[model samples]
Target: MTHAATANLPFKVHDIRVEGLQRLPVEKVYAALPIQAGDSIDHDQVADAVKRLFATGNFEDVQLGRDGDDLVVIVSERPTIAKIDISGNKSIDEDNLRKGLKQAGLVEGEVYQRSTLQAIAGELQRQYVSQGRYGADIQTKSVALPRNRVELKIEIYEGKAARIRDINIVGNTLFDDDTLLKDFELKPSHFWSFIKGDDKYSREKLSGDLERLRSYYLDRGYINFSIESTQVSVTPDRKNVFITINVAEGEQYTVNDVKLAGDLVVDENQLRPLLVIKKGQVFSQQLVTYTSDLIKRRLGNEGYTFAEVHGVEQDTGSDNNTVDVTFYVDPGNKVYVRRINFTGNAKTDDEVLRRELRQFEQAPANTSLIDLSRQRLQRLGYFSTVDADTPRVPNSDDLVDVDYKVEEQPSGSIGANVGYSDSSGFIFGANVTQNNWRGTGNRVSFALSRSDVRDSYSFSHYNPYYTLDGVSRGFSLFYSKIDFDQTSVASYAADRLGGSVTFGYPISEYSRLSFGATYEKTDITTGDYVAYDIYQFLDEYGDKFNEYKGNISLQTSTLNRGVLPDRGWSSTLGLEVAVPGSDYGFYKLNWSGQKYFPLTRRWTVRTRGEVGYGDGYGQDKSLPFFENYYSGGIGSVRGYESRSLGPRSPGMIYVDNGTVDPSPDPVGGNLLTEASLELIFPTPFAPDSRSVRTFLFADAGNVFQTEFNDAADNVSWNEMRTSVGVGLTWLTAIGPLSFDLAKPLNDQPGDDTEVFQFSLGQVF
Candidate 1:
């Protein structure tokens, strides 16, 4: 600035001019100038403008001057940032560090300020220090570049986190140090600390640990417990931290009585039963809090969304240490839902989602119904995430809007493949399955496959909500030609065509009764050599026949989740009978059940059982060989091939060669029984426990026949095949894939034992 600009005398400015501008607009400088054309100004005003310009941080220096009624503003502009490269950052991700620097105005392509860099470095140091990285260091450099730009580089050294060396608890007589510190997340250094990192010190972690310690006492009836002080110190080497906590243990208090004393919108009798803290019980902060929450939720279910409930303790004057408790209830406004809206459901229809909701618009908000509705939507398995929020309506305290935002996931699979295999040459197949067909919540599936051993075509459609009363309707048609000669079975060929219609009635929320009718036509051809049992059966019942059958089943499930349930039980009991008017008259009864018991957050114990029996009631006098029950393999007894464990075929006899094969072929039996005990554990390295699971299972079962020629074929628990195995089920994009490695614990001489079994493209 010139001496005339700094004169104490006041003067009227005629014009203003800005100098030393690069990359910055002229308007930026004019905006910061207080003295403009035709405005009165003084020395203080000029200094004020100079100070304001510097405050903008765009100018390195600012001065004002006058030249014959022309105010001249001279300023030194800061350099724009050309590049910012941060290195030596290990504990923190580089992207997060860049974001932190950006928030402090130290980003690339913007004007650079040395003070901002210093501020960022200081803040970074403090963050690391708070995390117990006392030796953490930070250094910054600004390299001047051409074209009025600067390059910034930040170097960080995040030292190792300090380890907890000693944790001492003083002034506690009721509880020992180990008992109080057992649940604390922070602990003293010990072996394997490198892996668990529980010994690592952190200010935030310590705060949480202190709160846990306080809760531990408060929950154990120490009503007057108080923490005197807590001290933390670091060693000179800065590699270890010592923590000391002193607490005062007071007399235990017992509850004299629990009484409801606040505004009881609901009946007092109804709320009183909800209290977990009863008369003459030891006082517990945890129980009191739980009872308060329970009461609040009970009120919330009655449309009080903002209800508040708390238990207040009043110490009775006596040495008995008994206290009277009163629960204060504040039932807030009854909020009504003005509208229920949905979003992010691009493929699923509105009605599909609406049908699952128990909450409705234009009704008072019910907390239980709203939560249950959300759970139902999630259990549908069509959405990746289902979230519902009820926000109060603008300008209205009694009205709220319920909004559900869902992210849809592909609930179906479509696959096509063409390949050649030795067992099935020149294989060509196509299959499509959709659970939410056309956004209508219907299930549709179609399959077409061709190979040397088998050629199959099938299609099915099912509507879960076929009726307004939750009745399900489904029908399917299938045609298949199979050659048993190429498989591990007695030489035979069959061509079958069938169609069935099924109807399901919802008996209750967890129970359903279903009825189905089927008609099938079968044509069979036997090879020159076949199992003796099959040969005798084909001779009696003609190779070609038509059959009609009816089926009824009752199923109930109380599973907590639709996928990978960890709790609850499910059972299905069904019977299928061939109509008397048909070519065959037979009946089959089957029951299967499974129950899951959760052992921990990531472990579950499961028990499963299945039993089946079939026999003819009319002229046939025996179950058809094809309709017989065949056990063994993944779904039954592992370590045995599919349909490989059962009554033997006696022996395969070759009529052409006049030679008999000693090895027996598995010819299924009339009765089947299976039981399994499993320990289901979380899938190792799986991103989600719901999509994958692993289990160790012990299986015991075998098929038996009443018309057995030997004791081995007879129904006997001693003859039941047993196996132990580990299995993995992964719900993948293609479908559920399951594989198991099993070892048969008991195997008869004629029993078939295959260790490994697997199935792809199946729902679990």
Candidate 2:
């Protein structure tokens, strides 16, 4: 072709026009144009604008030309996403994949970016590979449709999971293979031994197990223990993987001597007692840590806010089996609290939080004070989280400001429940309560319940901190109607309306004493042939049937160590006394105590016991049925139903005949005592989450009349109602769920004990 010789002539653009603009406004095109009406166009600017337009991923092609002093911009828009299809994902369902892609900003009707599509494909492949599908293939295809949209299809071919062929452990002579294997969840099955069963493997879980093993050895004084190497290999066929762990088990050492070093604020003699380690003893990291904690705690109590104790070991040249330990104390600058701050209390008042703080501003910042402040806040139950940190002042190591952040949670709830029991069938109840009423550390509740045997409604309020120094006060009003088939006394039905006010005084942080009085009016309907003695007493005391009762109780609780409790103990003792001369005149006392001790790192032993007694006076010589103690079930004996283990009535009374004593002899109404021992084990599944606990328990208890002569005697093996069972306790969102499968060691005639019992909420 011959070229025209017009290179020197002026190049002119005819016009500038825009096409294929739907969502793109006409004004946008004009704004992007480089050449205005009557202006010469530059080829570089036109090329740049065209590149910018195509970079938006909104157009497939762009053409720029000139028509007489105007630039012509023509574009072909890329197709929008119309449909998405996914297939061949069994391990990961299609819906989940779609959701994942959607979260990554992919959806129909949006402009499709090639980079984003490629990223999605890569992510999908990675997920499949993680699931052990090494040979899996993923391909994505797009089809253009009408209306400038496209459809996408993702096809996957996922093969079987990669199996584990062998797991080999080297350089361990202390424990056998079985013991080490138990720590690992991976195992080889008979059919797939070559591939190690193709089990689903979790790298995180394996890492955790290795850490556990390390800690297990370190805690036993193997301080130099180390993992040499870890290797995982896959077979040529990609069907199985082999794991190998090489470890270096250093020599076990014993403590030769323990000495203190550095600037010690406390006397050496005083500090030596706190060190739990002893000479010639098996060196234990736990003991060393315990001693460090003890020193820290003592220093904290003395207002040494910034104190640290580090246990250092000096190796002796004796076969590498012995070491002398020294505790080096670094007493940093004594920190003083410049300020205390609280945050995240939108609903609660600032004063409510300030009053609970044990550590005050302008005071020495001590660890114990901060811990006590945190506990005080926790006891209010207002906040779900309370964290304290000492943010040091800039350029001043001695000055620090404490920040106490609290996260307030919902303190009110409306709950309804329906329950059934052999004694009280079809029980239904509901309640509305606010534990932190108006953020004042008070409780208010309204409850209504109805059952086949009883019906009641009650309103109550309590101020946990009624006084500035920590006294509590409470008041309750209730109306109840009870129908009883009293075989021991008489067949009668009574309705009562009552109210009571109580005041509780905290003798100390661990103990409290409470006094309360109630006024109740009871209307008893008797048969024509009622018992002569009861009829005479009631008739003589007519209109004076209104009864008044008063009670005084003392309760105490203590925990030597509150967190990570292993050696210390917690106990509670309660004694309640009812005054004489009241309508139901009797003196009742209830006492309970619990203790926990750790025998080893993995073993914990706990013991608990409870006793209840009542003595009658005046017209009534015994406790009322409502006031009697009933034992059995998870909280009590764990082998029987509530209130069903004592003297029970045989049948209902006949009004016309005034027939009493339903059974040949009643066996359900009596004072009770119980004792139990438990061994608790921490679960390995979720160590940090204290949601579940496993326990093996042995329980023994019995119920008897107040006048029973042998009440204080030690229960013999034959006399004791013993039960052995394993319990699973789950700290659920609602409350703790205790499920136990118990078998009674000794069974009496006509006993209908259940083989399994599942209960919700704490027994205490």
Candidate 3:
């Protein structure tokens, strides 16, 4: 910018000339200038134009000049960013760092600013410090390239996270230091801290810990407790952190009285019983909050979705040890639902989710009904998250709309694997399963497996909402070959080819009635040294038979959860009868049930029982040997070998010199009974894990042969086998894996006792 160019600034301009512009259009320069062509300008206007051009951050410098009424603008454009590269980043992912940079207006193709780069560097450092990485280092550089572009590079050195060396709580009188520390997630470094990682310090985690500390006192009737100050100091090397929390422990208070105020929709007496806090009980913030929630829930059930219940407390006298609590209820207008909408379900059809909803579109917005709808979708296993919100319509106060958002997850699997099981021997299999086939909420599966004891090929399909009225339909086709000789049972083999079609109708909200019709062909093959029971059945009936069967079952469940239930009961009763056209007419009845009682937030007690009986009917006089129920396995008695318990058939004793070997084949019985009691607890390290659980269980069960054995003999109470065990079940990517360690308490002479049992793809 020369002095002569600014001399004649008030002259009229004919045209504008832009100089020294690169990667920027001449029109943009004209648009940025305050003075344009054919316009007269003054010195101040000229200076203002120069200032405006520089404000765009695109120009390094701007010079204003005039030549015979034509204003000339000379500009030096800033370098455009061409690329951004990052390296040495670990704790914070590279993609996220680049995203943050872009959000801060530092993306490629934009003009680069030196000031912005320094600000971004400071921001990056602050982020690392919040994560306890006080020693993290960050460096940025710009490399000039052809075409007036610059490439930005960011280097990061993520350091070790600071660990807490000590945590001290000062001025604590009501509670000891150890008790207060137990409520904090951050702990001092110890031998096991490396694995638990609780010693690692983070700003967000520390803040949350302080909140928990406050809640601990507030929930225990310390109404006046206050946290005076909290100090956190880092070591000189920034490798360790020390935290000290100071507090004032106030006197505990007791509840003076409880009263209900304001407009109560129902009778005050009706809501009084819903309160958990009594007049004589100690003041508990947690109880007050819980009671308020309960009141809201109770009102919600009555269609008072917008009701508000707030607890107001008043202290009396100088002692200040008694607080009067009053719950004020404001029952607003009862709101009704206007419409239901679904979002974020691109892969699933709308009708599939609509059928699961219990709340109607135009009905009142029942909170419980909406919650049940979400639970139903979660139980389908097709989504990872299901959320529902009822927002009021823009201009309507009495009508609200229900909106459901779902995040879909993988609901199908296709794979092949090779494994081994003690009961089935070496196994190889391939399977294709889809629980939500094509997002229609249909389940379809096909599998083929080969093992030493069993070989099977099966296909099944089920539709849970066949008619949208809570009816279900399913069909299955299977062919299986079982070798009993490998199972420590009778030396016999059976090949069964069968197919069945089932239909189910919902009897109630928690119960269903189902019926199935099946057709099968069974070919039983006997080998040498077969059990006497099997030989007798083969002698009476042919080795091959064709049968037609019908089954009816009723099942009901009220468990709070589908995977790991905390409280509820479930039961099933099934009856299978061979129709009149079967070669061997028979009938089987089975009853099973389970009940869970939550003893505490982290502990539960469960009881389970099952009973089964089978007998021949019509022309047949007794149950077929192969159809008998055998007890003792992972599903029955834990401390016994698979299907290796029950009545035993005679076998020859070999005598070689002075040694005698006894071989007894386990012959399954027609009647079976089993019961179990378990104390379930959350895993120690993962107390909130829904996929893992541990339990101590006691099991008692046995198989009885009634026809050949007298009722007073084999059916006695002493004949039942018993075991006590500790078990664990973990749900994994492949399937659920279960392990049990048991000790047989009442083992008979010939019973096979196995102290350790494990199985895959099974749960208890």
Best model number under TM-score: 1
Backbone clash total for model 2 is 23
| Candidate 1 structure quality by residue, lDDT tens digits, 107-182 | 7898898888898989999889878999999989989999899898888889899999999999989889999899
Best by the lDDT measure: 1
lDDT of each: 0.84, 0.70, 0.84
lDDT of 3: 0.84
lDDT, candidate 3, 127-241, per-residue tens: 8898889999999999999988899998888899999999999999778989988978888999999888999888888899888888898788888889899888999999998
RMSD of each: 3.0, 8.0, 5.8
Model with the higher TM-score, candidate 1 or 2: 1
Which sequence of candidate numbers ranks them by TM-score, best first?
Answer: 1, 3, 2
After aligning candidate 3 to the native by TM-score, how far in Å is the CA of 46 from where it should be? 3.0
Clashes of each: 0, 23, 1
TM-score of each: 0.92, 0.66, 0.80
Instruction: Using lDDT as the measure, name the better of candidate 1 and candidate 3.
Output: 1
lDDT of 2 by residue, 278-318 (tens): 99887888788889999987786666777899998778878
Error of 1 at 117 (Å): 2.5
